[model samples]
Target chain A: MGEYILAFFMFRYLRLTLRDTEILSKWDKLLQAGMITSAVLLGVEIIFDSVSQYTTWFSYLLLGYIAYLIYWKAEFSQRKSVFVAVLPFVIVSFLTKITSLTSTEFYQSWEDVYDVAGVFSVIWMIVMLVITNKQNKALAREREKTLQEEKQNKIISQMKADLEVQVVQRTAELTKQKEELQQTLDELKNAQKQLIHSEKMASLGELTAGIAHEIQNPLNFVNNFSEVNKELLEELQEAQTNGDLEAVGDITRDIIENEDKIMHHGKRAEAIVKSMLQHSRTSTGKKEPTDINTLADEYLRLAYHGFRAKDKSFNAIFKTDLAEGLPKISVVAQDIGRVLLNLINNAFQAVKEVEKPEVVVSTRHSAEGIEVSVKDNGPGIPQDIKEKIFQPFFTTKATGKGTGLGLSLSYDIITKGHSGQIAVESKPGEGATFTIKLPKT
Target chain B: MKILVVDDERDIKLLFQQRFRKEIKNGEMDFVFAFSGEEALEFLDQLVHEAVLILSDINMPGMSGLQLLERIKTNYLEPPPVVMMITAYGDAENYAAAQRLGADDFLTKPVDFKALKEKLKTLT
Candidate 1:
């Protein structure tokens, strides 16, 4: 009965192990049939009191077949223990059946042998069950570890994907900010260009009256000479009709001289017009060799004459101390011309109220570079506002009298554009001097 | 009669010589030129009462025509020379100042030489 019970439990274990395998399911069914047959044969011998040798042999054969199936088809870790557990039962049953078949006298001894083998088989089965239980527990712990590793791997991958998304979002935001900054920079550049143009126009407006006077002087000469030439021609005709060859020759010479004067004055007017155009035109930012002395003298006269045109009572004695044979410096002529004009105009304004107003413009070329200075004999700048003069929109003049951009623009032209320096020296109640220094390169 | 023409423009001397060529040739008028008010004063000082008429530009660099006129009216009292002020700025303020300074006449530039010649003829 104990052997039957062990066989039934072993059959159930094999079925559980081979449940999902199609090939192993046949072994499971076979083990179940063997267990049932063994039980029925045992019941027939016990109840009918007649145990046929054939029936006994058949039952032992069925037990051996089930033991082989368990050894062949069970899970690898539990296979050895399960096969060993059923081994003792199969050997004992077979041995008992064989001895009974051999001789009747040996049947009694075989029965004793059978009982001892049964006891040993039961003990072996219990030991194999404990070993199989330990193996299953180890296998279950290994499976749990593998499952935990897979879960950690999935979580790590998810975090990496999230980080990539954050990086992409940050990159897009930076790109948008960069584009906005570039757009703002473009707007500022356009505004700077407009301001430069407007400032040039303002200076041109101040020069209009002076330019008119400059052109008018030459035009007067041209018209007067032409009128004189007409008279000389009439005089020549009279002399010819009178048959006075000497008077005719003299009058013809006079007409020639008058024509020369007209041509000279016409050329002068043309030059003044060209300069006016140059002053008003926008700068092209091209550098050319320029004579600092000539520019200084020209702007000095322009500023003086401009002031005179506006206020006939405003008069100043201007002098020049230009260095002879000074080497020409490369510069943007229009921009430098604007700076000189602004400086000279400032000097004129400084000396407007002085009793004997005097403005001196000087240019010098040294080993270092070229220098242009404008000095005035008037109330000099105070110590406090001297530093603020070059700052944009800083002016001591009345609101409408000065644009305040004159010195600031000049500062930019000399410093930023040309890589030059501009400075001022003044003694209050005495005089002020502005100096511009430019590099040779 | 001798006439003094004062202007800062050096070419005024040539212009005057040519414009009054007939008067000069006929010995009806003699012309002298000074480039500035200072030069005109120096000339008047050297040759007292020699010039009968003075034609001057108002907008000179050092001494203006009005200032010169004032000096002349104050200093040269024995039949002060007739001074005519000329300027490119024909504004009323200059005209009033010249009149107040005892100017004999005022003229705007692009000076009408024909009218000037006729006016000079009456002066002669």
Candidate 2:
């Protein structure tokens, strides 16, 4: 039972310390061969009683060889310290048995002590194996935890990369949208400029007939007087040829009067031509100090009459409330005139169909500068359209009747040209008032 | 031949008389003056068929020459006076309108009196 217990401890130590199971299995076969040799040697000693001592010595030697194989040859590194610690005790026990070979009692007592020490060493080996197994399990658990942390770290880095990609993509999309919006704004600005130019041409077309008619009067006088002078000159020559002093004097006096009349009409035509040229010229954008009241009043009547001349049935009640003692404002007169003309013309058009059509032009001294307003008692501007009224190409008038750039051009003149402010206020059914505030010099 | 000259400018009357002074003195040409289209229409009404030629301006304060041309074509059917339309501006629309109103000729200012005299001699 003791040998079997020792063999079990040796098997457990070999299984625990050997790196490969195959090496441990080979050690197992060698252990089995030594144990069978020991049993066969004991059987030979018992069968040949005459050679008992020799067979016993041989068995002892074989047992020491088996101990050397178990302790040194097999892979038992975990139990190596225990084996080294017990080596001196084993040698002392073997020496005690060898020296007291003739003293049977002493030898028997020492063998009993050796058997007890062997049992204690086997118990110590079992305890050491248990400790080594616990240490190995703790190390495996730590390694698994490290692997799991590595996997988590990889996933987190992948997520960070994905987030960076999304940020880059979003920024690119915003930049593209911004570029598209800027392009659209540029196109709109270009279209607005073209519309304003076309509207100006249309207004000039309307003014052409009135200007032509105005120039015709002076031209008629000039032609008529010149022709009459020519006939009078011929008559004066005839009177001189006939030697009639009284007839010659009358004819020469008539020719002089006709020439004076022709000169007067010629100057009138020149004045008309100068004014037309001024109207057609582009603004020099130079500032001049001018009376605000006179400027407002002149443009109002001009616009009103211009509309009336076009349509004979157009009748609008005109009213003015020009404030006295207003300071002169420095502005480009032609640009301001254009703004006023556009506003007044718009007012007249608005009130053309009203039951009590009225157009009121008011000028007054403001705290900062001068304020001019054109008000009309017509169907007022709607809320949705009021905001867009100053935008180019926005109009409520029928096609061919309006170019839709009048108010926009006016806005440009008042705001951008003169550094003034223009705004509109309206009650849907009452009327609309367009106000211009200009700076005083 | 009797002729009616219509224009808003009063100087036109003196002009016509001076240009045809010898003709008027000889009684070869008789000239009458009307200051506007309405006045010319009034003179046309009073004279009925006395005037042989009517020269009228297209633009006037009361009634345009085109309007007068329409009135003359409709009212003066029996031996209608040969009407010539005159305007300061020879615009296509006004020319077409004058023609549509049955004007005998279209003239632009300042009127060519030599051409007028040639046409007049032929008509007479």
Candidate 3:
């Protein structure tokens, strides 16, 4: 109802401003209405008449309209609040007006305005405190979130750096291992080449020596026969010139006899040379199941012949312990032949210069394989050189006497080629023994 | 019969000449000298068995004793003269190779004269 009254009064004021057609004209009407309402209410109360009371009630209606106009026009900072701040001035205006009307009854009207204003003011203070606390907590929460983000970013960067360093370290380690393996492989290839070359040279050496011995027997007879034939031919010429018929027959018989001898020895020489050529031409002859005892014996003879040609005084006595019931191994006859030849020859040479020259070749059967050993009664290999002997190009023999590749190549052939194992047992003075073991098939 | 000793080194030739002096003086043998393996081979090729034994030293600067030995054995099968190879290196592998190429005997140098005489006796 009071809001209705306020709307009515603002409309009348707006009419006055518009109709008067001047800004000052609206303010003159607003002041006139205020003074008339105040004076009319005072006169009615003084008269104590019911008819005038109705006219005085219009004054309250006018006050509600004026207050509404002022509330609408107010700024937040400069204007008094409608419900709280303005209530004090409004109570003061209501009191002074009532007091002018009835000076004794003024306290009763003052209490009504004071109650409305005081209640509104207390409500305003509670709302202000709540808004302030919420804004402050929001700001504090935003700062905490930003700090957490910074800490997360720092940790992530550190992890990235650590991962990069670890990757680099691992890559370097792999590269080092790769280089080391490559270097080892290169060295192994070089050693393999030298071993092959030495093996070829050794076989060629054997071929030549075999040829030399083979040719010697036939060549002798040829020399003897040709000389005798030449002598006989000359004598035959003399006999014809001198006219000795009987002497011619003798010369003829002598030439014929020498011719037979020539054929006999020449054929022997041819067969031997052909065989030596065939032997050297082929690499690692067809493998066969060969009795280890037989191979040992044959190579032992050849080794003996080879060494005897070099140094006749090196008559090292030989002994063999051929095991019975031993299995015949499938082997490349010539390759194994060469290995045995090298070992036996070395053994013989080792023993030849010793006080009592002696060599022993022995064969035995073991669970792993067939073991063949050649031992000598020579001054044993020095401890240092024993290990070195198995290395390519390492030799204990005097320079030019031994191509150190012999044993190293033998080791490869035995271990890698035949899938066998070779070991040496030696002492400084007792002697040395070389043993080769082949897996039992 | 006479055997020619051919080598570059004076020591090797002198050793051969001195070692066989007794047989040479007795008219049982005679010695001739050539300075190189080539000269030795040439002399032998000409005279055939006049030099029944050609003891040669390998490792000469030109035309090694081994080359001479090979030539002698391959070319002249008839009465192929006995060739004993001598070297400072008693390399058995070398010996085997020499023997394979038709070397009758092999000797390491600083040769004991007595051993040489015995080898010659077998050839004769």
Candidate 4:
């Protein structure tokens, strides 16, 4: 049985290491020889129970085969071969029993070699167990570290996703708030413009009143004397008719020349007073039903004359289209007059620097409202500042030339005072149209 | 009748003389001109009796017509001269102020000559 266990172990070792057909055949032959010898020895021990000396010789042959295996596989694995070499001593007590059967003296002499071989086998087993335990512990530690890295990566990705979501939400909120702030800024700018425009209008009104008062005195003298001279002329003619020829010549000459001076200056003063009244009349506060066509036509001519007084060489082709039979609207005539003046003045300025300057003022009665448009052939407003044009103190004119309150005041007069609408349309190189729409109500 | 015309304009002296030449020639009326309120007051101080009428322009370089009217009403109490206030602006405020200041009449510039003649006739 012991020989069969050794043969089985040798076969397992040969299957693990022997890949060459030549090495495999040698191992197979040695294993067969060991098995046949052990079988024959077992039969001899059964037949001659007293003659076991031959069994000891068979164990020595087995030990010699194990030494040969150790020498042959030494280069393959030194540690495994050393462990296998010690395994042969596990059956050393059976070898001693067979040697005792042969001669007691021979058994006593081999006892020390068996003990040393048994100790080597025990040491090999302990070393193998320690190595295996350490390998297992290292493998478990590596698995745990990999697991921890994977968990940390999952948490980081989750945090990144949450941060992205929060950023998106915050960006949306900021964008909405920014839009609201921008809207408030626009409203504040509009209010500031309105305040500046009213201030300018107040100063302008005062200046106009001063001029009116100053001019009226000279105008009064001209008219008074002109009337008195007319009476004097009639008296002089009546005197001549009664046949007073000697005194008549001097009187007629003096009176006629004086009448001419009176009439000439009288007409000049009248024209100036009329122009001043046309432009500078204070608003009456109460609404009056008025013919819009007459108001527009009168103001257009007055504005033209006013511009002419400033720039003697300025000339423009002015056209008007007054819708006939339009219903008379109730409005504060002087206030509406001021609005018309501002729009017409702006139109004139717009066309001043352009070739073939033309200003067309047109009125139309429509289902929407009373539409008045002041169109000019001039370099139009640019797109960027188009929305800001009506803001107070926003002017394209040279400083000191314009107060920049004309359009702003006009906007207030039309939109707030009259509950009307004013809008502009323009292209960069083309002309511009400013339309004022007053509701019929 | 003698009338005092107060104004700062030098041209007014000629204008009045020319306008009333017929009346002056017929000896029906005479005009004494004062260029300022001070001159008018000085002229009134020298006169034994106040002029039959006084026409003064409201806007003058020195003393205004309203101030002259105040002085005339206070200084000449015996036969209070018919002091008419004339201004270039016929605004309500100036008119009201002149009337409140004891002006006998208020006339806007380019005075209606016929209207002035009638007022003068009635007063005479």
lDDT of 1 by residue, A96-180 (tens): 6667678767878568767888788868877876876787778768878778887888788888899899889988989998999
Place model 2 in a CAPRI quality band: incorrect
lDDT tens digits, residue span A347-408, model 4: 87787788677888899999866888888888988887689888867888788667777788
lDDT of 3 by residue, A340-393 (tens): 878988888787668657788899999988999999888888878886888977
Residue B6 in candidate 4, Cα distance off native in Å: 2.9
Interface RMSD (Cα, Å) for model 1: 1.0
- TM-score of each model, paired residue for residue: 0.71, 0.51, 0.42, 0.42
Pairs that clash in candidate 4: A220-B109, A220-B110
What DockQ was computed for model 1?
0.59
Residue A243's lDDT within candidate 4 is 80
| Best DockQ among the predictions, by candidate number | 1
True contact recovery of candidate 3:
0.00
What 10-residue stretch in candidate 3 chain B is worst by lDDT?
A: B10-19
The alpha-carbon lDDT assigned to residue A43 of candidate 3 equals 59
How large is the C-alpha RMSD of every model relative to the true structure? 6.8, 10.2, 17.7, 20.1
Evaluation by DockQ, superior candidate among 2 and 3: 2
Q: Point out where model 3 deviates above 4 Å.
A: A1-151, A154-184, A199-211, A214-287, A305-315, A319-327, A364-370, A381-428, B1-124
Worst 10 residues of 3 chain A by lDDT: A74-83
Global lDDT of model 1: 0.82
Question: Alpha carbon lDDT of residue A29, candidate 4?
Answer: 65
